[model samples]
Target: MNKNGNIGVTSENIFPIIKKFLYSDHEIFLRELVSNAVDATQKLKTLASVGEFKGDLGDLTVHVKFDENTITISDRGIGMTAEEIDKYINQIAFSGAEEFVEKYKNDAAAIIGHFGLGFYSSFMVSKKVEIVTKSYKDAPAVKWSCDGTPTYTLEETEKADRGTDIILYIDDENKDFLNQQKIQELLTKYCRFLPVPIAFGKKQEWKDGKYVDTDEDNIINDTTPAWVRKPSELKDEDYIKFYHELYPMADDPLFWIHLNVDYPFHLTGILYFPRIKSNIDLHRNKIQLYCNQVFVTDSVEGIVPEFLTLLHGVIDSPDIPLNV
Candidate 1:
């Protein structure tokens, strides 16, 4: 049955507020959406690990693609039911503006919208947003769409995949997001070390005087990064290889330290003392931050001690509440 209803919002101006105030930058919408996909993929992994889902854990890759009118981010992860769409998408769960601000006050990338605003962040760049999803359970697929307003339409749909696809109808103001180069740059910046592989399109090659896509999908993320594995599993060359993955253009580090502690909060990573050629202050953002191997941000002054930001490396931990 098709359903139509108004999204539960305090005021009609809520969409504008989300566009202007909820996120500091429009590019952050990409990170929030991709992170949500990663969360879904991770949840499926957990379920399969516990033997709750007796299905093959197929290639759990998140994909980002765009055409002339829309940009679609699809993931082979656990999807939601129609009722879940009503609860999570149509409802505004946060109490008020004060509580929202207070909750994310310290987070620079803004907390993962735990208050339920992350999905809506798409409005900052899209005129209309669509979600076509099929749950792993034996439930009917669903399609939910909203056009930059409090009203939304929901209905049953046919989907062969067992995951979610978030489609954003690009707006004129945010047309830059439709560019392949821009999209690649954003993916590299925000999702280089994500736990799940992310494919933007396909690997391209020069053929017949034109660039053509090869058979391989252009997977953008490193699902198993150096920080997530044990120190014993990695040799000096392996560490160096991972370093080049993180910093492709930088020189090899002089020495590196591996941190693995699980007491108060889980933390594991490799810290490298790079050959600094410039002022110490210039190398502050050498370290990248990750939560459960999802690339959070390069700005780690808030998490890493100020004095320690001079070094180059990656830190992955679930304990650190990354606002990004």
Candidate 2:
């Protein structure tokens, strides 16, 4: 079946709000898309663990690829059916750009992504966006596409895999995202410790004064980071190694704290205090926040106590609701 309709929102004013508000930090689109992919992959793992999914869980990794015109983020995770698309995409039940603007019109700082507007953030850089998806169920696959407008198209599509691919046709203004070096840097900063492996093109080597791709995949995340594991299972050297992994060029941390609380809210991470004889302000906001391993932001003033922002480390918790 094929379908076309306007996205069910009260206002067409949402697009302008997203472009104007999110323009200052539009690079976060990559993080939001990749984080959604990780969430899907992790959900599949959870289903498999609970004996709900009987099929083989294959290489559950996310891939980001770009050509001249489009950038595609693909994942071997639980995908959405056509109806799912209608519910999640076409419908606007949850809080969104419209509500966001209305609620925080007076206070700009209060304007964070509390609404589930992360997917819409693609409009900050893309002229058109597409989602090609095949659910793990036996249902048929589908493709949903939209310009930076209220109307969108949904149609049946043939897909050989059970996953989703978010394709963004880059706009003229956001051409910097097409560069390989720039994409690599963004991935490193935003998704280095994601739970699922993320592959961006292939391993490259310098040959004949130019970089060439190798046969191996250029996987970019640490699936089993130190923070996500049990403290008893790791040794002292493992902690040091993980610290260096997070901050490669910095001096060694003076000491560290392993947080693994699972009661009221599931929070697990490692806090490292570096030696600071002077310049205390320089070390503030070094802690990176993650939700189930996908990097949220280094500005973690909301989740952790205000005092803890002085420490440097990784804090990952699915419980903490992020505005971004």
Candidate 3:
């Protein structure tokens, strides 16, 4: 696994797979990487819940940082060993997410990755990618790297941590990702309500002449959004507050419904009845859909009833399918 070799592929080379996924939307790379990081952190929590892991789950926050040439996403989750890296990262057929779900079927939480392509999606916007990880089981840290090719390198590395760090070298064409404004917008759109707190940068405030960074971290998402909690635990003001968060300019909701169903399939959300001011067409697609708190789509034409789309609020379910 340490030597350079072509990535595991049955038919076509790795280049085609990158191109195939790239055509849909390269910005999706951010979502895939973030979701995978959340999944890893969740799996660690699940393991701890089942009494298999007793160590401290200290600071499980997923941190995303970017500079002119690189975007780094670091997670304090259950990292991979040398062999696990070879099997999961190097071997596409193994499908790490699917295997983990099946292996921990009785105890694991809902994972995001279905196909093994989530991690590889980085190649869509990157000329090179490197993974630095150390397992929670007292294994040595290892670094795995690959250019925009089939060949990859793996070797031992020094890392004073027990998680994974994914470093993506922004390609010349995808330099837009290097901009903090653009990255912040993408993070807000896709991960505003993720279960884990994502620290992108520092809170900013106007000082003498210009904006300056504060000591506090700028956490993007709300870990305990109202929708994820029980309706009984939330008050009327809570729903209204969440509604304003969703649509700031809109007036307060006339009424709301807390939908909670678990018998057939898991589902939980809040729907707000808003005052109809604009034309009916303007509110056609106000309902936002989520799967496991990750924003999936707003166009729920094929998934839900037509009339439901006119309402405002969120509809989340782990049963919903994800892109990668």
Candidate 4:
């Protein structure tokens, strides 16, 4: 029961295994990390609604900051405790982080969170990873630091906020994460309409000779995405408008289905079947998956029924797995 220590697994080739396989696209690591943060935040909202924990629900935003050295993802969510970290991060056998990586190194997307190994994928592009977090409870903030290895160190830290900040020291090979344009593109691709607002940088406007910072933040996501709202509350134009937002270059959608079911399983979303041109593979993964409006995955085949994969639209279901 080691907290923030070597991931208690017998596998020694786990790191190399994950780097070699698991995901089809290296860029997907960003999506998995961000989606996890969104899920954590949404879980807090669900808990608060049930009157589980009475606390001030401050601005729930996911901030993605990148510099020459690192890429950081910070969120004001229900931060994990020491024990929770041990259960989620240190233990991999129960979750399947190692097996999936070993099985599917050639196909990147296959290396996804098949076994709750989403967080470990950071090692693929990062030499070192740090988690500075403070739980919603009265517990002190803690800093968990780890190199690209199984071992880690967790100790107390000075943080006034009750949330988590994950910093990934971009590896020399994966310097693309440091590029502002690349980061922004990934955000728009994977998290255009996340439940929480995601801010990458400051707003810019044309000034005297060049662009200058505005008081506004460059918020990347639509806090209240079209899929999160009720179909009854929205008009046909609204769905069409959001469709354009997702595919500005394409024509209008053919038809759509507003899914909202809260019984055996909780689900809510709007699936649109866009007109196809040539091959169906071109539009295979157009349907984006979201957990409580937080963008999870665009390549959603396992979560949605097989027939729905060819459609083009947004599906924001809190019950769906982000790694699926």
Tens digit of lDDT per residue, candidate 3, span 1-324? 356766786543555445443545677688889988998899999999999889999999999999889999999899999889888887776444344445644421122255457787788889999999999888899999988777889989999989999999988988988998999998999998999989999999999999999998999999888998988899999999999998888888889998889979999999988888779635643888888999887877778887777788998998887642
lDDT of predicted model 1 = 0.83
- The window of 10 residues in a row where model 4 has the poorest summed lDDT is 94-103
lDDT of each: 0.83, 0.85, 0.83, 0.78
RMSD each, Å: 2.4, 2.4, 5.9, 3.7
Worst 10 residues of 3 by lDDT: 104-113
> Which regions of candidate 2 are displaced past 4 Å?
94-99, 106-113, 206-210, 280-285, 300-303
How good is model 1 by TM-score?
0.91
**What is the overall TM-score of model 2 with all chains considered together?**
0.91
Which 10-residue span in candidate 2 carries the lowest summed lDDT? Answer: 106-115
TM-scores for all predictions? 0.91, 0.91, 0.90, 0.83
Tens-digit lDDT track of model 2 for 15-48: 7777777787788889889988988998989998
- Over the stretch 21-94, how does candidate 1's per-residue lDDT look in tens digits? 65467887888799899999989999999988889888898989899889899988889899988988898865
Better of 1 and 3 by TM-score: 1
lDDT by residue (tens digit), candidate 4, 202-271:
9999989999888787998887877778778899899999888877877788888987888888878788
